[model samples]
Target chain A: MTLTKQKNQLPVFKKMSTQPWSLLAPLLIVLLGLFLYPIIEVIRYSFTNLRFGRIEYAYTLHSFKSVFTDRNFLDMVRITFTFVIFSVTFQLINGFIVAFAIYIGEKLKLKGSVFVRTSVIISMAIPGIIIGVIWRMMLDESPTGILNYYLSLFGFGPVRFLTDPKIALISVIIANIWRGTANNMILLYAGLKTIPESILEAADVDGAGSFRKVFSIIIPSISPVLMICGLLSIIGTFNTFDMIMSLTGGGPAGATEVLALSSYKEIFVNYSLGKGSAIAAIILLINIIMAMIYFNMNKKVEV
Target chain B: MKNKKTRGKKVLIYAIYILTAIFFLFPLFWTLCLSMKTVPELFQVPPKILPKTIHFNNYIHIIKNTLVLKYLKNTFVLVGATAFGTLLISIPAAYAFSRNKFRIKNNMMFGLLIFQMISPLVIAIPLYSYLAKLGLLNNYLILIMIYIALRVPFTTWYITGYMNTIPKELDQAAKVDGCSRIRIIMSIIMPVCVPGIISSIIINAMSAWSQFIIPFILVDKGEKLPLSVGIINLQSTSEAITTHYLAAACMISVIPMVLLYIIFQKFIVSTISGSVKG
Candidate 1:
C-alpha cells in the first residue's frame, strides 16, 4: 500500500514548487525590523550626545572618549571581570564535583539518588529575580538577616554582606554562583553521560586510579563541553542585570557595578543615551569576540 | 576490607551530596519558611526557624492589596503570546532551513546566532527611544514583539536541529503523496517534533516570564508590569517591604516556572546539552 502510494504521488512532488524563503521570510522580517535594526540604532546613537529633552544633537565621539577616560568606567570593568572570573570559577568547580558524584551514583545504582537530580533541577529553574530578592533578604545587615542568624549561632558577628563596599561584589558573586552552578552541573553531567563505559572499564582493568582516569580520560573527552559552558557562563554573567539591580543596585558606591548595570544606570537613571550606547557597544564588541572564538573552537571540535 | 572501603567512599559521597543540597537549597527553604512567619517573627532577635503559626494571611494580603495577581496575568499574557508567536514563526523557518537548500542559509543562521549573543540591555537605550518615538512605550504589543524577536534565534536554532533529526525520507514520501509543504510540516514534522517545540516554548516562556530589564524599562504602568518587575517594585516601595509579604509574592511568582520545570525537567536538560553538542 505504501509503495503504491509513493509511486502514484511521485509526479506531484516535481510539480509543487515551494520556495524556502517564503517560509523563512517572517522570521527574517522580524529579525531585521527588531533585532538588527535596533542594534544599528544603538551603534549610531552611541556617537551622538543625545541627552533627554534637549534635541539639539551633536554627533561626536565624546561619549566614547568620556567613557574611556572616566575612572568609574575602569572600576566597572574591573568589577565586571572580577565577578565573572570568581563566579565562573566557583560554578565550574562545584558543577564538576556534583556531576561527578551523580555519575558515580548512576554507576553504583544508588537508591534515593533521584532526589539529588531533582534538587539540582529545582535550583537551576529558580528565576534570577527571586534569587536576588531572597538573597537580599538573607544578606540583610541586621541581626534579623538569616545568614547573620546562622553566623551568630557560631558566635560570629553580624556581617554586612551587601552593604559594605568591600563585601558587596563578593555577595553578588556568591548569589550568582548559587543560581548558576546547578545549570553547569546539569550540562556537565550530560556531557559525562556521553563517555563510553568501555573506556572507563578498560582504565579500571589497567589499574588506573579513579582520579587518574578522570584527569586523563574523562576530562579530555568533555573539554569541548567545558569550553562551551565557560563561554556561556561568561556571557550569562556579563548579562547579569536584574540580580545586581535587586541585590546591590550596583551599590556601596558602585562596587558591584557591571557593564550591564552601568548601561542601565547611564541610560535610564541619568538619561545619558550617548554614554549608555557607548558602553553597550563595548559590551557587544566583547561578546562578539568571545562568540567568534567559541565558533572557531566549536568547529575544530566538530572536525 | 575492599568492599568496606568502597562502601565508606559511597557513604561519604552521599553525605557530600546531601550537604550540598542543603547549602544550595537553603535560600528557597528560608523563603518558604519566612513567608509563613508573622511580621514580628520576621523581626525577632534571631529569626524563628519555624513560625509558631503558619500565616496564610501573607498570601491573602498580597492578593488583596497588591498587583501580584494582575502581574501574574500580565506575565502570562506576555509569555504566552511570545511563546505562541515564536513557534508560529520559528517552526516554518526551522522546517525550511532544515529541509530546503538555499544560499545564505548558513549565514542567516549564523547572523541569528550573533544576534542571540547581543544582550537586550546593550540595545535597551535605542529600543526605548525608538519605542518612545513611535508612541509605543508601555505598549503590550511592542513588548511582546520584542520578546518574540529576542527569543526567535534560539527557538529557530533548537527547532532546526530537531528537524534535522527527522528523516528527509518522510518529507519526500509526504510530498509524493500529493501533500503540500505546509501539509507535510504540519501533519508530519510538527507532530513528530512536539518535544522540541515544547522545549522551545518552555525555555522561551521561562525567559520571557522572568525577563526583568526589558519589561522594567519598557512598561511603566504598575498593572502592566510582569511578575519579576512587579515583585521588585513591591520590594523597592517602603510601604510594601515587609519580609513575609515579599516572600509570599516571590513564591507566588515562581510557582508556575517551578511547576513547568517539574513537568519538563528532562526536556530542559536535553535542550541545554543539545546546544553544546550543536
Candidate 2:
C-alpha cells in the first residue's frame, strides 16, 4: 500500500525527494575519508614491505608470511584466544546471573532493586581505562593492594597478580569481567523482559519448577540475546587494548599479549608498519567474521 | 511449607543481589578510600580499611603539581568537539536515512553496521602514518576528527532509530504546509527526540572522554595527552609517590562520568538496550 502511495506521489514529490540524498552526503563523505579510506590503506599496507625505513619497500605477501611464521605469532594467538574465550564466558555467566537477580527483584517489587539497577548502570559508565587503573592498583602484588590486603586477612601472603605469568592473564580477565558484567546484566535483563509472559505463565500453570521454567522457556526465548551478548563480549574483549595495556602491558613474559596489542606494539613501539598492518588485518578479519555471525543471528531474532 | 520455601528463596536471591552489587561497586569505593590515604597509610601492613586522617592533600597535590588540570582541559576540549561534530554530522544523516526513500538506503544502513564492527585498532597504523605525514599528529583537532568518525556511525544509527519512532504524519503535514525537510527535522523531529539526542551526546561524550587508543597513538606530546594516557603515566611520573596521587587523580577523572550516569540512568539503560535490540 505504501509502495503504491509512494508511486502515486512520486511525480509531485520528486523535487523534495532529493533532499534526503543531500543530507546523507556529509556523513557519507566523512566516513569515506576517515573510516573507509583508512581501511583500504591498511589492507594495502599489509601486503607491502614497508618498514620504518630499512629498504624492502615492495608489494609482496612477505609481511603476511612472516606474521604467520613468526615464533611468537602462535603464542599471541593462544593468549588472545584464552583471554577472549574465558573473558566472554565468565562475563556472560556473571552478567546473566546478575540480570536474573534484577529480573526477580523487579518481579517481586523488592525495595533495593532500584539501587541495584542504579549501581549496575553506573558500573557500565565507568571507563575501561579507569577500570584498568583501579584494578591494576587493587591487584598490585604488595600488601598495599586491596585484594592482597584482604587475602592476608585469610592467612594468605601477598600474591603477584600481574607479575606472576600464571596469574597475569587471569588478572586481566578478572578486570575485564569487572568491566563487562554490568553491560552483560543490562542486555540480559532486557532480554529476560522480552520473554513472553504467557509462555512463562503457561509453564508455571503446568507446575514447572524454576529451573525447569528457565531451561524450558526462559533460556530458549532469550537465546538470541544470549548469542548477541556473547558475541559482543567476545568482540569487545578481543579489541581490548586500553585495559590490557594499563593492566599488564602484555607483560610477565608476554603471557597477556593479544592480537590488538601485538598490532599496537608492531606499529608504534617497533615502527614496523608492514607487520603491524598485517596483524591488524588479521584481527579485522576475525572481527568481521564474528560480526557476520552475530548479525546473522540478530537477523533471525528480528524475524 | 510452600510459603517458607518461597521466603527462603527470596532471601537467597536478595543475598546474591547484594553480593553482586558490592562486587560491581567495590572498585569505585576502594578508589575513593585509597585517594584519602597517606603514603604511610597506603603501605601500612594489611592496608587500612579507612584512613586515620583523611589526606585531602593528595587531591590538592595532584591538582597543584601534575598535568591533571591540563589533561582535564584537553579531554573536555576533545569531548566537546567530538560531540558537537558528531551531532552536526549525524543529525542530518539520521534525518535523511529515516525520512527519505532514497536508493541504496538499506545498503548504507548495513554499511553503518559494518563500520561499527571494525575496530579502530584495525586502521591505527595507516591512520597514524597518514596523519603524521599531514603534520596533524599531537593536535586535538586530528584526534577529535578521528573520534567524530569513530563515533558518528553509531550515533547516526542511534538517532535514526529515534527518528523512525516519530510518526511520518508530522513530516507529511509539514511538507504539505510547504515547510522544507530541514526545518521539519529541526522544528518537529528534533524536539521529540530530545531525550535520545541527549543520551547520544552523553554516551558519545563519555566514550570520547575515556577514549585511549586514538589519543594514545595520535598525540605524542606530553601537554596534549588526555587523562586516559596521563593517568597511566602517574606511576612513572613519580616513582615512590605514585599510589595515592594516582588514586586521587583517577577519582577526580571518574567522578564526573559517575555523576552523569546517576543523573541519566534511565536514558543510559534505554539507549543501550535499544541499540542492543537493533
Candidate 3:
C-alpha cells in the first residue's frame, strides 16, 4: 500500500529524497574529510615506508614487517593482552561489587547507600590523566607518599610502585581500574535494576540464599549488560593511553607500554609514521575483532 | 529468629556501603589534602592528612607562574565550539534519518556504528600527517572540526533515537500549514527535543573537555593546549614544580567537571544508564 502511494506521488517522493540528501550533506562531507579519509590514510600509510623526515615513500610491506619483527613487538602484544584482560576483569568485579552493595543497601533502607552511590561515580568525572596523577601520588613510594606513609604506620616501608618493572604494570592496572570502575558500576547498576524485585522476593520466599540468587538468577538475567561492559571495557582499554602516559609513560623500561601507547610513541616521539600506522593497523584489527564479538553477542542476546 | 538474622545482614550491608564510599572517595580527598599543603609539607616524613597551614596560594601560584590561564581560555573556546558544532552538524542529519526513507540511510547508520568503534587514537597518526600536510596544524579551527567529526556519529545516533519519539503527525500538520522543513525543525522539532539535546550537549561537552590525546598530538604550543594536556605539560617542566603545585593544577582541571557532574547528577545518571538500557 505504501509502495502504491509513493508511486502515485512520485514528485513528492523525489522532493523528499532531495531534501534529505541536502540535509545530510554536511555530515557526509565531514565524515569523509575527517573520519573515512583519515581511516583510509592510516591503512594506506601502514603499507608504506614513510618516515617523518623523508617525503618519498614506497607502498611496500616494510612497516608491517618492522612492526612485527621489532624486538619489543611481542612484549607489546603481551602487555596489551595483560592490560585489557586484567583491567576488564577487575573493573567489572569492582563495578558489580559496588553496584550490588548499592542494590542491597537500597533494599535494606540504608541512608549510607546514597553516599556510596555518589562516591563511586566521582572518579568517572575525573579525566584519565588526572586519575593517573592522583593515583601516582597515592602510590608514591616517597616518605611523604600517603599510602606508604600509612604503610609505615603498620611497619611496612615504601614499596616501589612505578619504578619496578615487575610492579609498574600492576600499578597502571590499578589506576585504570579506578579510572574505569564507575563506568562498569553505572552499566551494571543499570543492569541490576532490570531484575524485578518480585523475582528476588520470590527467591526469598523459596528460601534461596543470597549467593545462590546472585550467582544463578542475577548473573543470567544481566548477562547482556555484563557482556556489554566486557566488550566496551576491552575496546576502551585497548585504545586509551592517556592515563598510562601520565602514570607510567610506558616506562621503567617500557614495562607498561600497551599497543596504543606504543603506536603513539612510535609516531610522535620516534618520528616514524609508517611504523606507528602499522601498529595502529594492528590496533584497528584488534578493535574490529572486538567489534565482531560485540555484534555477535548482540545478535545472540537478541535471539 | 528471622528478624535477628535480617538485622545482622543489614549491619553487614551498611559496613560495606560506608567502606566502599571511602575507598572510592579517598583519591580525591588525598588530592585536596596535597593541594592545600606547603611544598615542605609534601616531603615531610609522615604525610599529614590535614596540612600544617592551608595555602590557597598554590592556586594563585599556578596562575601566576604557568600557562594555565591561557590553557583555560583555549579550552573554553575549543570545547564550547566542538559541542556547538557537533549539535549543529549532527541534528539535521539525525532529523533526516528519522523522518525520511532514503536509499543510503541504513548503510549510513551502520557505517556510523563502525566508525564509532574506531577510537580517535587509531586514526590520529594519519590525521596528524593529513592536517600537517594541509598546513592546518596548530590551527584551532582544525581541532574543533576534528572534534566535531569524532563526536558527530554518536550524537547523530543519540538524537535520531530521540527524534523517533516525536510523532510524525506533527510534521504532517506543519507541512499542511505550509511550514518548510528547516523552519519546522527550528520551531516544532527542536523545542520538543530540547531536553534530549541538552543531554547530548552535556555528554559531548564532558567528553570534549576531557579529550587529551587528539589535542595533545595536534596542538604543539603550550599556550593553545587544553587543560588535560596543559596541566601535564606543566608537570613535566624542567623547573621541577613541587608536588603541592602539581596537585593544585590537577585539582584545578578536575573541580569544574566534578561540579558540573554534581549539578547535572540526575540528568547525567539517567541519560547514561538509559542510553544503554535494553
Candidate 4:
C-alpha cells in the first residue's frame, strides 16, 4: 500500500520542482558555522602541539603518545571508569527502587505520597554545583560539620568523607545520586502511570502478591522506559564534571577524576590541547558506541 | 479481617512515604535552617538544627554586598535570548522535518540525535578558541549562541515528535483554502503546537538558567557571569564559611525557579513526561 502511494507521490514531487534549498540554506549555514566549524578546528588542533603562548602547527603524535604513556593518564582512565560504573549503577538501582516504592505507595492511597513526590521534584530543581557544595559542607570532616556532629551524638567517629582518598569517590557518588535520582524517579513514575490498572488487577486476581505483581506486570510494562533511562544515566554519569570539580576538585590525588574532569584539566589547567581533545574525542566515541548499542538492542526488542 | 489487614498495610505504606519524604527534603530543610542561623551558631559544637538568633540580614547582605542583581540580570537576559533563539529556529525546522516529505529527512533526524548524544565537554576546547577568535569571549551573546546550538537539537527532536502527532490533513485542508505554506504553518501548525512550545520554553529556560559549565568556561569577566557561576565565585572567594550568606545566595538563585515550578507545575510535569515518553 505504501509503495503504491509512493509511486503516485513521485509525480506530485516532480510537479513541485522548486527545491526548498533556499529555505534550508540558512539553517545549514548556521549549523556549519556554529557547530561544525568548532569541531573541525578542534580536530585540526588535536594533531598539533597547541599551547597558550605558542601555536606549534607541526603535525605530531607526541601528545597522543604522552596521553598513552603517562601514568596519570592510565590512572585517570581507571578512576573515570570506576567512578562512572559505580555512580551510574547505584543511581539506577536507587532511582528504580525509590520510584517503584513511590508508585506502590501511591497505589495504596498512602498519606504523604503527594508530599514525597513534591520533594523528589524539588530535589531535581536544585543545581548540581550547589548540591556538591552543600554535600561537601554536610560531609565535612570537621567536628562542627552537620554529618560529623550528628555522628558524635551516637558516639561515632568522624568518617573522612571528602578528604580521604578511599571515600572521596563514594562521597561524590552519593552527592550525584542525590542530585540525579529525581530525574530517574520522574521518568519511572511517568512510565508506571501509563500502565493500565486492569493488568495489575488481573495479576492480583491470579493470587499474585504485590511483589509478584510488580515483578511480572510493572517491570515488563516499563522495560522500554527503563532502557532509555538507563542509557541516559550512563551518558550523564560519564560526562559529569561540575559535581566532582566543585566537591573534591578530583583531589586527594585524583581519586575521583572522571573523564570529563580529566579532559577539562588537561585542556585548560595543563594546556595540553592535543591530549585533551584526544580524550574528548575518545569520550565522544564511547558515548556514540553506547548509544548505537542501545538503539540496536531497542530495535531487537521491538521486533 | 481482610479490611483490617489492608488498613494496616496502608498505615505501613504511609510510614514509608513519610520517611522517604523526609530523606528527600532533608537537604533543603537543612539549607533553610542554616540560612536562618549565624555563622558562629551554624558551626557550634553540636551543629544547631535551629538558629538561636535568626539572621534576617543574610538575605539583605547578599543583595547589598554582592553583585547578586547583576548576576540575576545577566542570567535572565542569557536565558531569555537563548530560549527565544532556539524556539525561532527549531519550530520551523521541526515542522519541516515532521510534515514535509523532504529528502534527507531521516538523515537530519539522525544527525540531531547524534548531536544530542555528544557531550558538550568534547567540543568545549575548540568552541572556546573559536569564540575567542570571534572576539566573543566573556560575552553574553556567545553564551546565548552556544546555548541555542546545544539545545536546538533536543528542542527540534521534541517539537518534531509533537508535530508528528498533529494530523497532516489539517495542513492539506489549509493549503486547499488558498493558504501559502508559511501561512499554513503560522496559522494552522503554530496554534496546534502551543503545548510543545510551552513545554520547550519552560524546559529550555530552566536549562539556560541552571547552565554552569558553558558559562563558567566561556565568561571570564565577573560582570558577565550567570547566577550559578556567580554563586560559585562568591563561595570560593569568601573568607568565612558564612552559611547564612551562602544560603541567602542559594535562595536568591532558586526562589524564582521554585516559584515558576509552583505556578506551572502541572504543565511542566506533563510536558516532561510527554517529551520523555516520545
- Model 2, range A1-303, lDDT digits (tens) per residue? 011112325544455465576888789888998899989998999999887756568899999999999999999999999998899999999989888987987887777888887886777677777888889878878657788878888998678898898789999999899888877888888889887788888887999998898788887888888888898898889889998888888998999999999998988788888899999999888877886786567667666
Q: Tens-digit lDDT track for model 3 on A100-190?
A: 8888778778787777877877777888888888888899887878888888889986789899997899999988888888888888888
True contacts kept of each: 0.59, 0.63, 0.62, 0.37
Better of 3 and 4 by DockQ: 3
Residue pairs with backbone atoms closer than 3 Å in model 4 (clashes): none
lDDT by residue (tens digit), candidate 4, A201-276? 8987898976787788888988887886777787878878877777888998889887788888988999878888
**What does chain B score (TM) in every candidate?**
0.96, 0.95, 0.95, 0.93
Please compute DockQ, using alpha carbons, for every candidate against the native two-chain complex: 0.52, 0.57, 0.56, 0.46
Per-residue alpha-carbon lDDT of candidate 2 for residues B46-106, written as tens digits (9 for 90 to 100): 6766778766889999998888899999989998999899999999998887767767776
User: Which candidate wins on DockQ?
Assistant: 2
Candidate 4: regions farther than 4 A off: A1-26, A294-303, B53-55, B275-278
Q: Which ranges in model 1 have alpha carbons more than 4 Å from their true place?
A: A1-18, B276-278
Error of 4 at B158 (Å): 0.1
**Chain A TM-score across all models, in listed order:** 0.92, 0.92, 0.91, 0.87
User: Candidate 1 overall Cα lDDT vs. reference?
Assistant: 0.84
The regions of model 2 sitting more than 4 angstroms off are A1-16, A53-56, B238-240, B275-278
C-alpha local distance difference test of each model: 0.84, 0.83, 0.83, 0.75
- What ranking emerges by lDDT with the best candidate at the front? 1, 2, 3, 4
Residue-level lDDT of model 4, residues B15-37, one tens digit each, is 76676676667777777777777
